[model samples]
Target chain A: MSDASELPVGIADVEAAAVRIRDQAVRTPLLGSAALDARAGGRVLLKAETLQRTGSFKFRGAYNLISALDPAERDRGVVAFSSGNHAQGVAHAASLLGWASTVVMPADAPPLKIERTRAFGATVVTYDRATESREEIAAALAARTGAVTVPPYDHSMIMAGQGTVGLELAAQAAERELVPDQVLVPCGGGGLTAGIATALADRLPRAVVRPVEPAGYDDTTRSLAAGERVANAAGASSICDALLAPTPGELTFAVNAALAGPGLVVDDDQVRAAVRWAFEELKLAVEPGGAVALAAVLAGVADTADRVSVVVLSGGNTDARWLT
Target chain B: MSDASELPVGIADVEAAAVRIRDQAVRTPLLGSAALDARAGGRVLLKAETLQRTGSFKFRGAYNLISALDPAERDRGVVAFSSGNHAQGVAHAASLLGWASTVVMPADAPPLKIERTRAFGATVVTYDRATESREEIAAALAARTGAVTVPPYDHSMIMAGQGTVGLELAAQAAERELVPDQVLVPCGGGGLTAGIATALADRLPRAVVRPVEPAGYDDTTRSLAAGERVANAAGASSICDALLAPTPGELTFAVNAALAGPGLVVDDDQVRAAVRWAFEELKLAVEPGGAVALAAVLAGVADTADRVSVVVLSGGNTDARWLT
Candidate 1:
């Protein structure tokens, strides 16, 4: 196990990020449903980031990263790449801080996300997921316009920002006299899992942090198993567009590999079922990518028996028609 | 204009009920959405009772009333009459407290509610909403089974329980350093409205509490205006099945008439739009009746400009098909 001092993000950094985003980002509720508890045959607490600003936990990292930049850097603007949730988060956070933002998004991202990103006053550049690389597009844009590139997860500051979710979750759970045995976080580039794992290490050391991903995009799971970064097969696709990251981030993987428990993977059908379950049972709208952790829990992939479990519903930016 | 002592439900009662139900019921969050705030042109806080146990604030009242019963009364079982939400609440609460429950529900009530009520281990008796009187049916059932009748919102204990929503909201808002100028509640029998109004009278003296209802079922509005109970036209209908109480409850109106502000009404289309907006923007699965207050706010009928408004999303018990 890596020492806390060696991790890219630490509890102290998460604490600082919490202070920075305290006034700007929402403290989304840690919700519980008796129906869900019965289904899991144990207590289940949901960290509803779907209720977070920009309808995702991405705002925490985005705001933390942007707010820390100097005035000169802020004036130069920022660029980010995401399937949907992070784009909206960056757009909204940058707009709130009076900085222009440009996002490189998948061409087939849910229309609602694209529209909301634009509505936040960010210039959106759509790129084909199969052929074009979003990183190249964002890097080229940043290089051409002299804008700062705000990576989705890799940075220490970004991981610290996302770690606030874990900070809040641990505190909220403690308030309710709950000691969670495990926390399931949706893994994209593994930033959320790594951040949460680091926070949990400080707040609730006994609580295991597990990364959950869609089956085809289970690079984080494979990477963790191999004890090294492993890329997903090229042309792999799933309904969870947001979690289609090629591999775990180098920084995030370093932290997650040391702190996180074994990763969990769910299929598209399980994700769809979880989305429906969230709507019907939890009364929350969760997108396919956001529902992977929930899918793992509902699919009996997560061993929730005789334990208090926290499942993070990461985002809610899907089209209404998809829910129907 | 009502004094704290004069109200049937008071802050003290709500406080006591909050303590009683503290461990049993979920203390739902007071959520704020920037998107919703921008649309209202001011701050908008949502008291998400849709996240409450049994998917509505009804569980608070039901649990409070059922838990307070004597051992003999508990053994005799409990009976309740509701369009849907109250039935599920009473059923679930009674089941949790080891008491048998029977609910009189509208025959046309959402199938989801009916199914969930059964799932909660309640015996459900259905009556034609347009023809049969639910009160009479529940009374008969209670008479036959010697079960204690737990009226949805009429009783003092029930009102006290529902008032806890306001108690929590006030505290939550205070935590966020927000002093709400107005609170909008979706009114059916006025229990929730009266309870909230009474709580706010003590906690937030300057905040105006307004009852919002569907246009055709604006009995609470008319009742407050005329200083007497006003019944809706026979056979009146709207998509808001849960808010179709023929007239305001006598006990609830007595408290509301003095404590609540003038009522607000929204048409079915406005309500439908609010439900869709909740799904799209707020990411909450609010039923039509629960969306009435939100509809009033979204339709520009609530005067949200330059003031902090709290809208109560009362329930989430509609069929998924209806959301589509």
Candidate 2:
């Protein structure tokens, strides 16, 4: 297992994840709009993971991780730390597998998501963002309870599960006779971008896979440029609560560095504008974090070049107050 | 043509309309949520027409009507009168067919919808809701410009096109092996409800197709009870702007009276709640007007009877301010 861990991920990992998560994680639709196409100067297909169960693509990885746990480990339950989407995903996945789960979340997480996670039967442990470490709390809990710890994105299983998104999107696009010229994916710790890049490289060889980040939180971009894993500036934040990871995951960065094209960035204003545009045009509810890639498209980061562009709308757990 | 118009709509008409609109109109998906099913005490399938092209099922009817026009009539263009959804649909359809279109809209219609219709290149004529007749305005414009008047819901082509929603929903549900026990549709001029009822009766004979309307504009409910067509109370209005038709259409009402079950009603508050619920739970942006059937389900207007329930989320042209 250690030697295998040293090896880079392949399309086979993503294919296995798809089989593991089938019927459990939703196979979201790829939608399109003429208005978006006009703005991008090409056909823009939106793979709306917003419609996924728990309102994000995070569920695919979370569920895959939980289901892959050994029976004794699953019976001992699991512990995880997340802002919102991942929390709901793990909670719902654990509930489905009849495993007890404890999620350590930041106190400021969206109430709608907190309530939803609780509704899924996971015990929630809240911590202060600036003063406390959710990872420490979750680790301590796992130690005491003998529960398995499921890291959000660093693990191979998690990355492989997220890669299934690229697999599904490629097939769905091919079914529509659309071979994407570019695929823009929202990045946090680079897990999603890494997985998608690996899958797209195998499926759509001509497709350019790039990572999108918020302006001040462009750790992935800096990391890609520096040819190493890097961290976002401390104490910096954006409206995208779900995408505020401090640094790129070691394994994820390794995959993204080799497979991903260049990284792109969008400011908060552009993200908000994309959120409003999604409501007005695409008719999908996209959280600010999830809107970054779309914002990049609308902001011309990909420079669509009159070719077909595929953007992943990764999540939709926006606060009620943010809708306006 | 006149005799064909007099005949009640059949499944064959909807099937032919589907073929006509294959690549033109979007074939919307039937979605489901376990949380929603648990709340309703059974399974609840959502036919999300909100993601349809032009943001509503109205696109189907509008495109079907415009495409059926004779070559000479097409060259002369088309004129339509609508609250908003149908206006955008007709405007978009006309633009796609290389025809100029004019739409008579209410002065108080949502600014977002009005702007979108104009953006689709339709000429807009706004009139005071209290004292003006949009139909008369459209008729006059059609006569002056030698354009064909495309009535929003009354025409045979329009009804047949709208019925395609039922056809698509039935087929999608069948793919999942779900036979709906109750299919609840929002009622405006009753075209959608009538069309869906006709299609569902032929496809899913065990299903009960019901109409849902805003409380004050429950003309279809009153008409169904009275065994005759009836008009809404003069000057009645509700927040469900798209569902404010003065009365059911003659041909549409004929279909509904024969196939649909007793109509249900929900207040504006209930509609708003349903819209919010759709965003929060379904991760879909549903407008108030398009949420009435879901409102009826949430408000317990449809008891669901411990069986599979299907509700149509018909549009997603929400005003920005209303989202908050």
Candidate 3:
């Protein structure tokens, strides 16, 4: 295991990011439902990042990274590649900070997300998920426009910013006199999971942090098991478009590999059930990708009996019609 | 206007209710969205009571009233009549407090609500909405079973309990250094409306508290304008089944008549649009009844330009199929 000193993101960095994003991002509530607690057979606290600015926790990282840019870099703008949530987050954060942004998104990403990203005043470029590489398109655009390429994850600033969620979760849980035994977080490139694991290492050291992924896209799970990053096989797909990252980020995996618990995976059916449960019980509009952690909990992938578990609903950017 | 001393429910009662239900009820968050603010042309703070226990604000009043009952009354249990939200609220509250509950509900109430009410361990008795009197059925059940009758609204304790929403809203807004210029609440029997008006009257005296209702079943709106209680037409109907109170409650209307601003009304289409907007933008699963206040705001029924308005999403108990 890597020592704390070697970690790319630390508690102090997350605290600093909290201070920077305090005025801009939403301190979304840590919600509890008796119904959910009963179903999980444990004390369940939900970190509702679905209510955060731009409908996801991605805004925290986007804002923190962009805001830290030097004047010369800030004036040139930012570029990013994402399925949807990260795109909307970068677009909205850039718009708020008066920086131009360009986002490369998969053409098959949810229509609502594409519309919202554009609505946030960012230039959107679409590519086929099957054949084209969004990273290359974003890189080409950033080179041409002289904009800084803001990767969706992997950066120290982005990981630190997402760590604020862990900071808030621990504090909110403390207010209710709770010490979480486990925390389930949705994972794409593992930035949020790694960041949360790092933060909880200081706040609640004994708490187990688990990265939850959609079944076919469980690259993070396989990578963690293999003790190195691994890519998903070609043509594997799931309804959770936002969590289709081929592999975990290098910087993120370095932290998660040391601190996070065994990764968990849930299938599309489980994800759909979790989304419906959020709508019916929590009254939160959670997307399929965001509901994977919840899907894990509901599917009994974790031993929650008599324990306090915190589940993060990471984003809510989807077409309502898809739910029906 | 009636003096504070003459009111049946006051800020003190609401404060006491807040303390009584503090541990049991979910203190839902005051959420805001930049997208929503841009659309309203003002700062729009959403009081998300849809996240409240039992998925509505009704649980607050139900719990407060049942908890305040004497030992003998508690032993005998309680009976209530509701379209849906109130039934589930009273049932869950009673179940939590160890009191047996019997709820008389409209037969046409949403199937999900009926199922949830029963799931909460309440004895459910159905009455035809157009042909039978639920009040008489509940009164008779209470008389025969020696159970206390917990009216949906009319009682002072119930009003004060619902008023906790307003108390929390004002305090949350204050935390953000904002003083709401107006507050919009969905009105069924005026219990929640009067409760909030009373709370804000003390906390934010200058703020206008308006009750929003669906157009066809707008008894509260008509009653507020007519200077006397008025009932909707016998055949009047709307998709918002939870908000079809025939007329305002006696005690609730008395408080609302003195403290509330002009009532506002929105059509079913507007309410549907508001629900869709809430799902897409606010990431909240707001039911049609819960969306009326939002509908009024989105439809420009009130002047929101350059103002800070608080809109209460009162409940989220509806069939997902209806949303489609």
Candidate 4:
């Protein structure tokens, strides 16, 4: 049970999740990319989620959610709607719990993601992109199969799990000789951003939590300003496909809206340039979406003058076809 | 001063280096890439030196060597010869020590490397590749300027410093649930391999240490049987230019010869494929040299049958021009 008045995720939540998933997940290190740091005119530490299970932080939330299921819910299985990292996360989480998982992904999803979902023993339910709404299909599938719907980014367990990143980041930073002044986290549906924000609020209350999103899909930014949820009708016009979400989640928005200072938008060219920089300077294989926050720093969106700042590298599972 | 009995580096030498350089260089995490582990049919842990200072493991040796210098020698500064990561390592180390540094690099060295060394306030002396040898030029510069030459490898301090990688790997593996049965390290002048073997031997006494070398430059492999250092006549033939040393160091060879199980060689194609695999599957930007150990595993060079193994990702700095 989550406390109503508490920050979306507190140190307690992250601490609990850390202990629960300690053996299952990798404790990825926060690495300093010195070359990129110099180019940005400050210290840049990358919390490498690309090295996470299923190659993304999505696994953290998925594992945390699955692990929290009651015995009856576990018996009934779980379902989710995603065409990317979340699909793989749900599949992997289900496999770990020995529970059935049914993932609803659009027919147009990347072949690599589709193949990986199947490899993890999840039942893939594909729907025509033009005719069916993913949410509607997911609801139908859940109802028919008597499976519990695990809505990405809307649940307390998932948010608490993602908060483990912030918890680790705070602990990891304290271990350093010098602490950072700010932390840049890439925002999508707001799960990662909210998680980090909540953890930071409890641990490093003074450290600024800056959320970064692609230029066109600036719903989170606008929503925070209007004090209401704002959907992006323009959709994602940037090169970062992983950040193509139309709007922020209700629960995630509430968490980040109160904690996130502001959201910064970076151009597509900067995103591409940051991707190239990650490859050349940091030797990191980050997806365009994962590189957005770093891209902002490289493009001067944030406080490049800060002595020490961090950019959470959310994941690295990019499609091979994009490289060529 | 290095003990005479050690010749090159021993457990004691590495232990002292570890104590000296512990705060200077990062204790890079030994982590498992889940997809890579599944592919190998064994657990594959990556000691991410790409995440190290100067974007390679060379910082450990460079920092260790520089920090070991007495006040008198420290005033003389340091000189190094390299076209890649080592140049930046020396520059960064010197900068940390408040000493001037002079680096002799081939004119055709990667632009990024040259820029990085310069950014660290090192005086880079470029030499024509067809005319002067980098080593000869560096030696000449050191003699003229009274600067101490910090060879990329071969020196007892450097080897002992590099050996700290092995020490950290051993400690990290022991804390984890599954200890590695074998350790694969990329061998250039045998500094990293020797260091790792000495440290790994002390902890996992029964585990085998395999030094991975590019097929065209398998001097370490041949030297193991010849009972002497074997020099490559057709030097530096591979995309992995970082591992293109003409021969293993005499001191390092002695240490490695005592503990190394076997030397493994993989083709350029294997290294290239592994680089691509790191990018696509693991989402890591690995240079050809850093990918060689993974290449050996992918090409079935290692006995990874349910045994946990650790591969040293020695560096991530690559000539991005090659991608073009």
Most DockQ-accurate candidate: 3
Query: Over 4 Å off in model 2, which ranges?
Result: A1-8, B1-6
**Candidate 1, B92-188: lDDT as tens digits:** 9999999999888888888889999999899999889768888898888888889999998899999999999999999999998999999999999
Runs off by more than 4 Å, candidate 4: A1-16, A36-43, A70-77, A107-111, A125-131, A177-181, A304-308, A319-324, B1-6, B70-77, B107-111, B125-132, B233-236, B319-324
Model 1 lDDT vs. the true structure? 0.91
Model 3 chain B worst lDDT run, 10 consecutive residues: B315-324
Question: What residue pairs clash in candidate 2, if any at all?
Answer: none
| Order by DockQ, highest first | 3, 1, 2, 4
lDDT of each: 0.91, 0.87, 0.91, 0.82
| TM-scores of all candidate predictions against the true structure | 0.97, 0.96, 0.98, 0.90
After superposition, the stretches of candidate 1 with alpha carbons farther than 4 Å from their true spots are B2-6
Q: Give lDDT tens digits, candidate 3, residues A51-169.
A: 99889999999999988888565678899999899998899989888899999988988888999999988999999987998878888888899999888889999999999999999
DockQ values, each candidate:
0.71, 0.68, 0.78, 0.57
Which pairs clash inside model 3? none
User: Which tens-of-lDDT digit does each residue in B64-138 have in candidate 3?
Assistant: 999898756567989999989999999999999889999999898898899999999899999997788888998
Docking quality of model 4: it rates as medium
- Quote the lDDT for A15 in model 1: 91
The residue-level lDDT of candidate 3 at A233 comes to 90
Question: Could you give candidate 2's per-residue lDDT for residues B1-324 as a string of tens digits?
Answer: 123344578878888889988897777778877668777888898999998998999999888878877756567888999989999999999999888999999999999899989998899999998898887888889889999887888877888899999998999888889888889999999889988887887898788888999988999999998889999988776999999988899988888888886999999899988988888778888888899999888878788758888999999998555556
Tell me what fraction of the real C-alpha contacts between chains A and B each candidate also makes: 0.74, 0.74, 0.85, 0.87
Candidate 1: DockQ? 0.71
Clashing pairs in 4: A50-A316
Looking at candidate 4 chain A, the ten consecutive residues that score lowest on lDDT are A1-10
